[model samples]
Target: MDDPDSNAAQLASPSYRLPALDQDFLLGDSMRGVRFQLEFAKAEEVLRAWGIRTTLVVFGSARVREDGPGRHADWYAEARRFGKLASLRGGAMRDVGQVRDNVIATGGGPGIMEAANRGAADVGAPSIGFNITLPHEQEPNGWSTPGLTFRFHYFAMRKMHLAMRANGLVVFPGGFGTFDELFELLTLRQTDKAPPIPVVLVDETYWRTVIDFDAMVSHGLVSPSDLSLFRFADTAESAWQSLIDCCLKPHPPSDYVPVP
Candidate 1:
């Protein structure tokens, strides 16, 4: 017989044990959300090696193939190229687009995330990936720094980490999850919860169709000036240049301090 008090305690303080890679913990049809939470905690340990500060998040699609005239490849190549340029400034200085003090960050899976991480690795610069644990295991990209690949169970915590470490955000074409992330950041900025950092969206064709900024203005949904929140760039050169221009400008001292 199970004690009611013991059951209550278990519910209040959920505890989980890590299973071996081959083990199948899922039983029946029910999904245990807490499994992800535990996995996230386990992955956080990996990020401990790279303190979560001064990071740039490069987000895009994971399903994107490596070749075949895809914008995905273009996005990755550009990120890598810019990362190498940034790394030349040395690890001690800030890349503010050229300073190189911050690590390039991404989701640990493939596609755009892989591109960003690959870019950093190509330049021999450190990169960080905050990967999610799903029912289907998603492996870290080949370009990820050996020790820097991190896995996470909690989506909220992962987002928090991204918000905490990011000095800039570069977004590329992706799916639903990507939209969620982009909007979350936009909301945070609008609410004054986050400082205004450079937000660059790659691929003007897709973005223009997806986001009707002019319509929003026409409907009085948002102020026209609010459209300045993001800078759209079609090519890698334009994206890198936008970051350089923004970073080279003198940032207000208050904005430079890390949010506690």
Candidate 2:
């Protein structure tokens, strides 16, 4: 029977047992879904390329306006200070010598993120920013250097990049995202999945009221030594000095030659 049209119609219909990917039976917007999936893959590749090293991750709020008060302002201001210092030292060392490669990195958005990026740029030092695409928030701050700013679709991958490369983590006062990052890093170290990288909780006033490390100890959820995983700092200078002491010791196990 000459019924080719009818046969084609049956093959395309849902009732007919067909292949897995049916353009008709797809969920949500197909273009949007595929875009996100591609983005996720690209992000993983970008993060993996950075490799393991002594990197610093600065987690903070993206909504922090250039001006604010209390914790928000303090976090951004301190980030700026420390970022610039790190950049300067990095530049100086890389120019004629190779002391270390502790590049300052951030979430690649505004607020404290901006402060950190700004600081790095201020000293003309290359930095990294793991930018996430969001409809309402999370745009790469102006301070993020060209070629160093990257966007990620998966929060987990972005966070993984941060932890994998970090020799230390400096967390500024922030909301849910900040707390999530802080806990994850602490968990990794406590669980022995990751090395004991120095975690500095900036702004003691804000941090103390927000989360109780003692409470974790009180409930027997964590050991007393877990408290040693982090320390409190109030200023950029203090925090940078802490980093110098902790991560920037002479590499290669060789004696450090002081600058004459």
Highest-lDDT candidate: 2
Per-residue CA lDDT of model 1 for 1-260, tens digit only, reads 77766766654442443433313454212445656555656655555534434667778888776673756566666666655544333241233343334567788898888877776676566787888888899899888777777777678878987877677778888889889998899888877799877888988788888878799999999888777878888765677667766673322222243211
For candidate 2, lDDT tens digit of each residue in 53-139?
356788887767657865566677788887876656533224323433567788888888889988878756667888877877667
Clash pairs, model 1 backbone? 36-153, 40-152, 40-153, 80-119, 94-99, 95-98, 95-99, 95-100
Where in model 2 is the C-alpha error above 4 Å?
1-53, 90-100, 250-260
Q: What is the C-alpha RMSD of each candidate to the true structure, in Å?
A: 8.7, 6.1
Poorest lDDT segment (10 consecutive residues) of candidate 2: 250-259
Q: How many clashes in candidate 1?
A: 8
Best by TM-score: 2
Give candidate 2's whole-model lDDT: 0.72
- Candidate 1 TM-score versus the reference: 0.72
Q: What Cα-based lDDT does every candidate model obtain? A: 0.69, 0.72
What candidate 1 gets wrong by more than 4 Å, as runs, is 1-52, 89-100, 248-260
Deviation (Å) of 76 in candidate 1: 3.4
